[model samples]
Target: MTDDTMGRFGLSRRTLLRGGLGGAAALALGAPAVRAAPREVKISMQRSSVLFTVLKVKGTLAERLAPLGFTPTWHLFTSVIEPMNAGAVDIHADVADAVPIFTQSAKAPLTFYARERGAPSAEAIIVPADSPIRTVADLRGRTVGVSRGSGSHYVLAAALKRSGLTLADIKPAYLQAPEGAVAFDQGALDAWSIWDPFLAFAEAKRPVRVIADGNGLTSYHRYYVVNDGFVAAHPEVVATVYRALVEAGAWMKANPEEAVALLAPIWGDLPPAVVAAANSRRSYAVEPVERSQLGEQQAIADVFYEAKLIPRRIDATDVKIFQPPTGRG
Candidate 1:
């Protein structure tokens, strides 16, 4: 990792916190100090999300929240958008930075708290080793399997734009990462747009070649989103988890091999080298979301809108950012 990236966040940085429950208000006003809600919370992620998967396997979130009295229930989902909108989890651990734009357009009551900056090289478009596709231009009339509303989706869009083609130029196969892998291997699709861990696995186990990756075309930032209710109910706990994630991110960077080993068991016994290859491309530098960082999200939204993938134009930053909640003494 570069010194600049490492310096973006460190374990030494404390949350900019100042918030409290009505208990504090009650104390100040001399009324009954109403107890806060139960400390239990739910977190959700799909295996496709690398950081959340690592966090789940390491058991760090549970460990971090223990002192805070949180009862964290792990919820597995096919994708985050559904569970997030359905309120199945308080924390939607990591979803593609582009996804929330579509969700926001749908008016889901979710918000962004943390975001891992772009590691565009981590996401790519792969073709079978022997395929005749020589360039992004060659993909013009081919079928490409991709996860809908994913960073990989944005990667494919950005890559295509550089080739002077659009989504309409190719037969887009909207499949989840796993399904895309199967399709690519079985030749059900002409090419697969995927992210690492899965991308690394495909390159290792399947005869594939990266025809194009997201470098120079996109910023593959992933977001740690939360249910709006969770923020209102337990802002302190949210801040704590955010801190825990930053620490975990640092740990991942400092010890990549160990991170790979830790993730092997949870990722359906993925080979450590494949996991490591995947890990190599990621930043894993978790940071608080800022309005400035969100500039690319607007471009992502525009990409999806032009593709007609999203129903309408939406401000990518319309959802609230979880500030270090400020409160009365």
Candidate 2:
């Protein structure tokens, strides 16, 4: 009953455990308590991540997680999925729907935590004003520039499919936004598939014609993903991060001018007008990822596989979806 009595009986908790009882049994008999170690939350964000930038600027997530014994570390990435798959990132700010499909195809353990509502006009296939390309059909046999495995890549695929064509119909130039912009500008590419704020930047800098956007093709939903291990280890941290993201999105939408002013310097010093235009096309409403709404994700996966873009086909809904805590802690 007491430490003195147990010692007098030569039956201390450790002695009992050594006499063949287990740790749990010994704990039930009043063993010393164990403490969990503090965790480091590695959050990854792309340069174009407006809401995440807002969070970083305000240090909102860090403040929220500090009380939970978590130290938040932010990492900027150009290609986020690779770092996420390599376990270098604990939480990804957000990426296009096609990004997850590609990561899943590679067998990376990922969990969808939150999703931005679909913004159909956020990305498009554009061509120079003087170009002969008029519709998606005209893109056939032309050199099209797009980032490999990116959201705009899916837009290109869906747009081509709608016109009874595929990636093979065009000579694909796999390039990042800057490279694609250069190629498109130098009269090298027949068409370029891109997303905002790069899309807005390109349109403002030059005279271009939009052949197609995500309107009837892809939803262009951005998703916040987390490492499976992180989700299992610190669910509370995940919930906190998700709530912070939702709040940041709401703030960005509510205060457009302030959002632009805050983002302009961080966004390569792009003009406020360009930032506003880009922000206008995006729906920053963050919500849970519903299983029923993953139809487009499945479609993106199937299309990529059909076009031999991914190594193998993946079940879009096979990954985990995190639900935030309902009540107070």
- Model 1, runs deviating above 4 Å: 1-39, 325-329
TM-score, cand. 2 vs. native: 0.86
Q: For each candidate in the order shown, give its overall lDDT on alpha carbons.
A: 0.79, 0.87
What tens-digit string does per-residue lDDT give for candidate 2 at 166-268? Answer: 8888999999887888888888998999998889888888899999999988889999989898899889999988888889999999999999999898877
Q: What is the lDDT of residue 39 in candidate 2?
A: 71
Q: List the residue pairs that clash in candidate 1.
A: none
Q: How do the predictions measure up, each by TM-score?
A: 0.84, 0.86
Instruction: Identify the leading candidate in terms of TM-score.
Output: 2
Give lDDT tens digits, candidate 1, residues 1-329: 34454367541111211234345544654555554654768888777666666666778777777777786777787666677667777888587777787688778888788888778888889998899997888998899999888888888988898889999999999988778878887889988988877788788877788888887867788888888987888887888778877777899999888887888887778877788888888898888888767878888899889888888988776669986533311
Model 1 compared with the native: what TM-score?
A: 0.84
Top lDDT hit: 2
lDDT of 2: 0.87
